[model samples]
Structures are given as structure tokens and as C-alpha cells.
Target: MASLLCWCLEAVLVAVLAVVGGVSGQVEAATPRRELVPAMFVFGDSLIDNGNNNNLPSLAKANYYPYGIDFNGGPTGRFSNGYTIVDELAELLGLPLIPAYSEASGEDMLHGVNYASAAAGILDITGRNFVGRIPFGQQVENFKNTIDRITENLQSVDVAQALARCLIFVGMGSNDYLNNYLLPNYNTRNEYNGQQYANLLVQQYTTQLTRMYNIGARRFAIAGLGLMGCIPNILAQSPTDSCSDQVNQLVQPFNANVKAMIGNLNANLPGAKFVYIDITRMMKDILVRPAAYGGQITCLPFQTPCPNRDEYVYWDAFHPTSRVNVIMGRRAFNGDESIVYPMNIQQLANLDLQPNNG
Candidate 1:
């Protein structure tokens, strides 16, 4: 049955991509450029996690075969089979791929480090099911340690100046909903309605991002929540096998608050360029027409390998394939304001901010 499903999905993706191509014209490619940003510091959850979760005693790990089958280094711990969104973003920015925080040292810290851990969330307790995953707060602390190391190594390098000029990517909050509030065993749902919960998440998120700002992060690329209700895990719960409208609706406010937060941060923070990447819209666009994005709506179980990996939208029940990551990364890098509002990452990276002398 899995094989059949995989086969059908591959066919669907091929057709979808063809139709999408015919209608949308040629897809924009990421233009190679000189180092657009000084560095890219990443935080958040599995979506951007390269390998930080490998050593952690967590169930939310992807450190074995089939996980990095498409990636060159093989099971280096990215959730996807190949390059993550940050990896592609790094390429587009003309910087070397950002190393996972666990492995980074010396010169590796120069291009920035990725503190993203699979199963991480804005709230520390969000992914408690996974156990041992670094929370957003912890990731920030790890980044501070990285800064200390960098300063120690390059005594002449101005850490604050380097950070101010670098790009900070934050993609989180999905697990707070998926692994926390929505879980049957959790009390989060009883305490608050969807709107109230979203407010709570946003409040914590604001505090976390502010901490980053206080620590010298100035350029920000904040990815909004994607359509979690439409993922295969949620779809599997439905008797009709349809996307959960209720679940999808629940997350809309979180995305809205995130966008509002970006505006507020930009207005309040000196020299802060907070660019919002509308992953919600981008994923919906691809999900609505999987073929166009070379993605399959359904993913086979992790143990079962799909022959046409690039054609599948998702690699497992929750994460997108490396190909889809590339697609989304490229869009975030150069897509118009409709997809990545205010400005895309490319534009944000190239933006020159007046020194925050204050």
C-alpha cells in the first residue's frame, strides 16, 4: 500500500510541477553573489536544524540513513534528506553552510552557527515529548557561548559589529502547537482557546527575539508557521482524510501576531530589519498544487524510501523533503513581497543599516 501511494504521489508531483511551470513561467533561481550578509545565525526548530539534536537524548532525531540520503554528508542530522532551508539560504547569500552549534569552533564560528534543534519551540516545554532538545532560550545561550568563543579566537574582531551585520533566522512555534497544546495529554488546551494560546506563544516569542536583539542581532528573517493542519500526521487522523480546517484556523492568529510583531519590532528596534517570510502562504501555495512545487502531499513512513524523493512534498509525516526546502528557501531568498513581505532575505541581506551607536 505504501509503495502504491508513493508511486501515485510521484506521478501527481510530476504533473503538478509541469502545469505550475507552464502557467507560472520559469521559476526564479537563486543568484550566486558575493557575501551578502556577514553571517547567518539560525535558531528555531527542526525545520532549520542541521545536526544539533544528534547527541541529545531525544526521540525527535533524524541522524540515520534515509534522513540524509540526499545530503552529501549523510545523516549529519538534518531532518530533511538533503540541504535544509538555511543551507540553501547560505548558498544564496554566498556564505559557506552554517555549521550546527554542537560542531562549530574557531573559524567555523566566523560565518555564524546554527542553534536550531529538532523538536525545539518558543516555549521550553513545547517539545517535552522529545526530551533533551534545546529550547529557544537555551539556543540563545548557546549562541552567546559561540560569541564568546569567537571573541576569544579573533581578539581583533568586534563581536557586536559582526552580529549587527549578520542575518538571524528564526523558524519556530509549530511544535508548541503540534507537540504541546494539541496533544491529548496536555493541559494547554484547557487553559486557553486558540486565540489566547497564540497570544501566549507570541508573548514568549517576543521576549526571546528581544533577547537576541539585546545581544546584538539586528537583521532578522522570521518564518511564520506553515499549514500544520494539512500535514500528513493531521490528515491521517481524519476519517475523510481531509485537511483539518479547525487545526489550520487555530494557527492563523499565531501567524497574524507574528507579522504584527515584526512590524512592531522594526519600529521599536534601532537598525533592526525584521523581514517576515510567509511560510504559511508559501506552503499553502505548494500544497495546493504539489506538482508545481515538485512535491507529494503525502509522505510514506520514514523507514520506507520513496524512489522519486524530489517529487515528494514531505520526507516524513511532518517535515518537507530537501527539494521542497530548496524551493521554499529560494522563494524566501528572492520572491516578491507577496510571498515574503516587506522584503525577501536577499534584499534584507543587502540592506545597509546605520550603526546603532546608542
Candidate 2:
């Protein structure tokens, strides 16, 4: 009887151990995990600017009440009524909301930051004439300073490697030509012509990009000039609300020059990835079919009672609305195969994390 009792006791102990092991295994499976990707750093103008210009005294500030009125019913410094393209892209990537590189509150170094400033351009002197503003070169200097500050405080990971994985986004130069060159102030349209300006802009771009590359940035997403002539502001200047052919004619060579620059960058940097997101075709499609695109909104200058904004392209007179930004991001992330050589932003980042052997 004693021997039988011992056997039964051992069996009970084994049964308890089995139950505990099963519970631990189940818990392990239920836990969530996060995928790793390099940091995302943004640089440019109002196109990707997220309230960075808010704190700056620049006249280009767009973080006023009506700007973010659509987002949480209050101002968030975003030029749109809601989140900008940068915000949406961060959400898609599962990264924490990237703060405007200018914001003084809730700063985090590990995730990322935006150094974009409204009225900023590729050239150092691009927007200096504007009252109270930060130029592109200054913005880059500020970015470098910020990185130093973050490292000094955090002392977390390998800064250079972190930077290498960083996906640097640059969107500028349009305003340089528009507000500076094309406008009455410096209208070279009759003199230098469009092609000359295009060449100058490309040359300037090459210089700026090399600066970034030297700073350990390997991945780049450079968007080409959009259909500047089709913007509502430009159209408003016209008697019939028609797009300016002269302006578009200039844009063609500028975009081509930009494409050539990307090819050259790729050829020089074997591991580096450079891409161009064509905005002209996307803008053209929307302008051709305004009703189909959702650009219809009754805001006086925009024509009477606008239609659904989802289908349209232009958000305002100059910059794209959040809705339009989302559309562009989707196209950029998925439609690279149909465009010129280099892939889209999504593909470029993917390549950085998992480089191909062949």
C-alpha cells in the first residue's frame, strides 16, 4: 500500500509540472513583438513640414488655428486641417509620431525628428529674403546640432549606424524658383528661360545631396517638382483659371534634370539608394478630372461649393492637403516599378534593411 501511494504522488507532481509548462508556453506565444527598421529623418519645406516652422519667427508659419482645425479640433502646427504625409507614413511604419525637429516639447531622440521648415529651400540663400525665417543650410546645421544634443543626453545606441539606417527625405527647391525666381522679384522667365534654371537647380541639388551623403545618410527620397502651373494660386492669376503652359514647359526640363541626378547618385554610391517621386503626372491627373479627384471645395478662390476633396490633388493654393499627401504616399510606396530606374521610398528602405546579394 505504501509503494502504491508513492507512485500516485509522483504522478500528481508530474501532472502539475506539465500544466505549468503549458501555461508558460501559451503566455510566450501571446506576447507581441516589434520589427526593426532604421530611423526616418525628414527635411524640406511645407510639403513635409509638421509644425517645425511654428516656433520660428518666419512669416511662413502655418501652425495657426485653421491649419490643424481638422485634426483633434485644434492646432498641431501641421499646415493641413489634419495630419501631413509624414505623419501618415510614420503611422504606417509603426514608428512613434516624429516630432517637428523644431518642437521644444516631448522630444525623443531614438525614433526620429523633422527638420523641415516652411519657406526653406535647397540653397542657403533661397528664402533668406523672407522676413524671420530659417534657410535650408541653417536647417541642416540645426539638425546636426540636434543629433549631438540627443547623443549627449541619451547615450543609447551607435549613432553612426543609427544614422546609416535613417531614411532621409528631402522636399524643396520649388519655392526657391516660385517665390524667388518665377515671381516678379526675380522673373528670369524671359531671360535665363526654364531650361537654364532647371540646370542651375540640378547643379545646386547635387551639391546639397553630397553634403548629406558625407554625413552618413545612405537612403534618400527626393521628390521632383510638381505641376506648379496647375496650382490654384497660379490658376487664379489666369483669367480662365487655366494652368500656365509656360510654367509647365519649364518644369519638364527641371524634372528630367532631377532624374539624371538620381541616376548619377546611384552610379557613384553602390550601396546608396536614391529615388525620385514624380509629382507632375499625379498633379496632372487630378487637374484633368477635378470632380473625380475631390479637389472641389467651395472656398471662394477655389470655385463655388467644392466637391469631395478625396479625388482632387491640390489641397490649397500651394501645398498638398493631408488627404492628397496620403494619396501621394501610397503611389510613391507602391508605384515605383512604373517610373524611372530607382524604386520608391518603401523599396529603398527595404533594401537598406535587407540588401540583395546579386
Query: How well does candidate 2 match the true structure, expressed as C-alpha RMSD?
Result: 17.9
Taking the tens digit of each residue's C-alpha lDDT, what string does model 1 give over 54-97? 89888877777667877779888887778788899999999998
| Model 2 residue 248 CA deviation in Å | 1.0
The TM-score of candidate 1 is 0.90
lDDT of 2 by residue, 1-74 (tens): 00000000000122222322341211111122242345677887877777776776676766554455456645
Please give each candidate's TM-score: 0.90, 0.79
- When summed lDDT is taken over every stretch of 10 residues in candidate 1, the lowest stretch is 1-10
**lDDT value, residue 59 of candidate 2:** 66
Per model, how many backbone clashes are there?
6, 12
- Using lDDT, give the best candidate's number: 1
